[model samples]
Target: MDHVNISVANNEEKGANVDFDYSQRAQWLRAAVLGANDGLVSVASLMMGVGAVKQDVKAMFLIGFAGLVAGACSMAIGEFVSVYSQLDIEVAQMKRDHITNHDQELAEKENLPSPFQAALASALAFSLGAIVPLLAAMFIDSYKVRLAVILAAVSIALVVFGAVGAVLGGSSRVKSCVRVLVGGWLAMAITFGLTKLIGSSGLQM
Candidate 1:
């Protein structure tokens, strides 16, 4: 009887461990993906724009650094605020559900992420993504070569991020990757084109 009880206890523990739903952590996944995507595209676009106007390695590097810092900070603060607000709303909803509907199960099923966790994830992901382009173009001296390398690096990173996000979210991986790739390309192309156009017209940055 003791052995039987021990076996049952072990099974219960195992079941409890397995009961966690990964989908419940989707909020953090989304925040991380968004931060990474924003970091990649925005820094890549900024690098391309600066490259279009001035290919000075130092200038491009400075601008890229500034963008990474600013973007990461922005992502962290924005994600914290947004996630906190969502959590607040969820909590309020739970209260309403419990008070009005008396649905204890519904109120008790809160699997939301912490605002700090979401914010930290976003900031770290953004920093990681932003570093890719910076490292890719770090050693290249030629402006065209640097730009090409940055584009290639950014494209690969975006595709990977999109695919991972899709897989985690149970969406179509290929479609997500293609969509992110195209969006990234559009951003860079537009930024580069505008910079070149404006620079040529005597508004060089």
Candidate 2:
């Protein structure tokens, strides 16, 4: 009887650990998905906008590279600041709660969000997403084909990101995918259309 009880307790503990790990993984996935989506949409739209006005492959490459670098830096800085602020708030609250036990304090700190980690993750995810459109347009010489390939690549990536996010977040996959796809398409379309219009309106550069 004692042995059976011990086994049951061990099983429960393992289950709890699994749950904790799963939750942590979910949080990471959510952040990565959001960051990637932002990067992909922003860079793709920027490239599409430029492609509308200029068929020069060099121009598109330059714009896409600029967007990737700028976006990654922006994401890193934003994430670092935001996570640091949250960490400060949580630490202050812990102090207010008077958590004096050293071991407990250490555990809490371990569980707290790391600003450096968050920043790195954000930057990496953004760059990963932004690379899709860049690579799609890299070898293609035909202007129309380049734009089509970029759009197709961005659309596929958006769908993949959305599906992964939904699975990890336990949301509706179809809804998530549709929402992300539509949003990406709208962003690219609006940017391209407006840029084309402005370029055609006697606007230089």
Candidate 3:
């Protein structure tokens, strides 16, 4: 009877471990979904706003197409550079850990390996997570109002999502969200302002 109980306990532990692995995988999916959602929401909103101002369907379509193309390329480049920098930081951190471990061994200090491994995993996870949204947002339809809306929405959402990520990683959620939101809006404002400026120079048809 004792053996049976022990066997059952071990099986439960194994099941729990598997469950954890599955849950961890879900984080990647969350990132992907958020990316797509961002693209759709922002672009849609932008399209609606522009459509309100300019009833010329052709102009709106061109503007949206241009925005989508520009946003996707910018996102990709931004993500690549951002992730590359993160990778560098992670490498530096790992190197520091290695040196610390070596020093500890020399001085007969003791610590567990688990902490170092955990840190490494976290850094990699963050870097990879940053890329998913950019890629997903690149799918905005070209030459369509929907494309414009999607690109704008995704851009904003990605910024917000990044803030949420910072919070999840134990940072101040309000601060992170506010900072990202402000920066994102500033960018959108600049884009719209430039578009309007260019549009205004033309004779009112």
Quick one: RMSD of model 2?
Answer: 2.6
Give me the displacement of residue 48 in model 1, in angstroms: 0.4
Q: What's the count of clashing pairs in each model shown?
A: 0, 0, 12
Per-residue lDDT for 147 in model 1? 91
Deviation from native of the Cα of residue 60 in model 2, angstroms: 0.4
TM-score of each: 0.82, 0.90, 0.42
| Candidate 1 pairs with clashing backbones | none
Candidate 1 Cα outliers beyond 4 Å, as residue runs: 1-22, 98-110
Model 3: per-residue lDDT, tens digit, 1-205? 9999999999999999877665554444343334433443344334444544465555555555554555454444544555456556755766667765667554433222223333333334333333333343334444354435544555666566666656445467777666656655664566556655666788354
Q: Please, what are the lDDT tens digits per residue for candidate 1 over residues 1-205?
A: 9999999999998877654545565777888899899998998899899899898988888888899999999999998999889888988887776655546555454566588988899999898888888888878999889998999999999999999998887789999999999999999999999989999998735
Looking at model 2, which ten-residue stretch has the lowest summed lDDT? 22-31
What TM-score does prediction 3 earn?
A: 0.42
lDDT for each candidate structure: 0.87, 0.92, 0.50
Which digits, one per residue and each the tens of the lDDT, describe model 2 over residues 1-205?
Answer: 9999999999999999888877777646755887899999999999999999999999999999999999999999998998899999999999999998999999999889888888888899999999999999989999999999999999999999999888877789999999999999999999999999999999998
True lDDT of residue 120, candidate 1: 92
- Cα displacement (angstroms), candidate 3, residue 114, comes to 22
Clashes of 2: 0
How far does residue 199 in candidate 1 sit from its true spot (Å)?
0.9
Weakest 10 consecutive residues of candidate 1 by summed lDDT? 101-110
